[model samples]
Target: MRTLTELLTITKNGRGRLVLVSAEEFFRLKSRDRRAVQPAELSDAELDLIAKAGMPVECAALDAEMKGYAL
Candidate 1:
């Protein structure tokens, strides 16, 4: 995916689960851990996406990621 928004769309399509490696995404599997994090481990909103999404789950994840990032 070229952007975070696109990554989110993938998650929405995946029914709230996404494998993020080739793009900017909300990662269920950390590169270091090689372990899978449960959907319930995510924020309530992250777990709420429908298969046919009105918006991307990556948006919410990106927003959360931005909280700790600097320009």
Candidate 2:
């Protein structure tokens, strides 16, 4: 399957460049951009739930192993 970026059509214009996308894609992009400016904050209840449900054992093991290795 082609990604959104791959599906996009880009062309050089008189000014610089132009990107052509469908109305749906344009609105999706716009919504994402707006959310990026103001990210949502999690509520206290959500935080409590996350704290109660700790990381999975597999992820914990990976984290421990990664600590022993150099990046």
Kindly give the number of clashing pairs for every candidate.
0, 0
Which ten residues in a row are the worst by lDDT in model 2? 34-43
Flag regions of model 2 displaced more than 4 Å. Answer: 1-6, 11-19, 29-41, 66-71
Write the residue-wise lDDT of candidate 2 on 1-71 in tens digits. Answer: 65554445565664536666667777888887743222248677866886798776768767867786877
Query: Residue 54, candidate 1: how far off, in angstroms?
Result: 9.6
Please give the CA lDDT of all the candidate structures. 0.55, 0.65
Compared with the true structure, what per-residue lDDT tens digits does model 1 show for residues 1-71?
Answer: 25553443345654857544433333533444666688768676666653336646757766766786788
TM-score of 1: 0.20
Considering every candidate listed, which one attains the maximal lDDT? 2
Over 4 Å off, model 1: 1-35, 50-71
Q: Compute the lDDT of residue 60 as modeled in candidate 1.
A: 70
* Model 1 steric clash pairs: none
